[model samples]
Target: MLNSINTNPGALIALQNLNATNTELNTAQSRINTGKKVANAKDNGAIWSMAKMQSASSSSLNAVKDSLQRGQSTIDVALAAGDTITDLLMKMKEKALAASDTSLNTASFNALKSDFESLRKQITKAVDNAKFNGVGLVDKSAKALVFLANADGGSFTVNAQTLSLEGLNLTTALASFSTVAEAGSMIGKMTAALLTATNKLSALGTASTGLDTHLTFIGKLQDSLDAGVGNLVDADLAKESAKLQSLQTKQQLGVQALSIANQSPQSILSLFKG
Candidate 1:
């Protein structure tokens, strides 16, 4: 059986060519409007996957940076508490010096002992209260932040050990300072307190510095991820403009060629008679 051609062949060819031209024009328009070659995942499968990966990385970096910032803040709380503890120790030392005075009588010595013990109590209390959102770097309960080894898809941990301000080695603090002798136990209590305060201060300072270092690293990582995302998905205006002009030219040429193809069947009409 022959395929019957009832319609004008020239018109059919013109219609087909026009449809192709229209399709090309629609594609060019889409790219121009969206400012991206792969506006949808369906446009370019591999490129879309790469873009999604970049986006996820950028988001993960931001989250890590935020965690670092919070960690730094937690360290700040510990550091402040450490400073207070040192101050209390200094006050205890002052009271000890007063008690050491040779002229101090029994009542005066007793009073000095009482004041030094009170100050020691205050330091302990201060350490206990210094906490940021219940994450105490000082006062014994300190926790380190953990992150995945890979940004996505992994079972891993970035373990930073919890440190404590309450770990000060205050040996024989109240015991040695309780007695008022010729040497005046004030010196011993005060000395021990100073040593404890010193170690606590050092630990907190070290921890704070480490927090700053980690935060800085996280910030840099965020910046790097942002750059990668830009490279992968962001438009280059200059390049896009050039491409736009080239596509416009191609689109125009395509239309003209389609018109010429439509004329092919028109030539056949010259041999036809009614």
Candidate 2:
């Protein structure tokens, strides 16, 4: 090629090649630093958009998980209280049964009556205290609870249970173990109330199990969504590392090539000097 100081074609070509190498090297370095091939919309618009959408979904599931966890904890508190009420009912049954003995003396009967009343009051206390996150499952404060199940606005509901004395059909009149006949009547009521409390506990236990199972499913689903986002955007560090090394070497070579091309005009100077 003809050499000119004003326009050396070889230097122009070398500079163009070097610029191309520099661009590629910059891209490799960016990937290595960010650990992502498509870190932004400029990287790959379509893939980046998809990855952003999936990542948003994965993040939203965090809220859903929180809802489920709160629901689970609320149910756990109710279950604990229900179990306590069940045990207290069993003890109340024993107290009422003992009070039913007609041969018992007045002093003994009064003492047994006082004991039964104390147990009944304890059951009320358990029902009142079965609350979490401002929700009471056993006290009839909340009719039902709904928890977010997924990113699509799906939900699960846990029906509330009223375990109060009146709710269980165990009237305050039964709390009056003041006489032998009343004591005898309380035995039958206690049995029925015990059955009701046991059934409620069984149902609550099932609800808790369902919550646990769905929580596990949500966790796995979130993991899958995260993996999907990674697949769409994450760069292979090993491949990027190798590519960066290769590009660095090519950049050095490109600089040397441009330097040699720039010196081509010096040969014309040598000819003129001789």
Best by TM-score, which number?
A: 2
Error of 1 at 18 (Å): 6.4
Q: In model 1, which regions exceed 4 Å deviation?
A: 1-25, 140-166, 169-179, 249-274
Could you give candidate 2's per-residue lDDT for residues 1-274 as a string of tens digits? 6667888898889999999999998998899899999999999999999999999999999999999999999999998998898888889889899999999999999999899888888888998888997788888565888999899999999988878887777666756678888889888988899899889878888998999999999999999999999999999999999998998999999999999998988888887874
- Candidate 2 Cα misplacement greater than 4 A, ranges: 270-274
| Cα RMSD to the true fold for all candidates | 5.0, 1.7
Go through the candidates in order and give the clash count of each. 2, 0
Model 1 pairs in collision: 138-165, 142-162
Judged by lDDT against the true structure, how good is candidate 2? 0.89
| Local accuracy of candidate 1 as per-residue lDDT tens digits, 1-274 | 2223454555565567567656666666676677666777778788778878877886776666666566667667777877777787777778877877878788888888788677767766887787777766555555544533235533222222222223544433333354446336556755765676677567656755765776676567767876775666555667666766776676676677667655555555666766
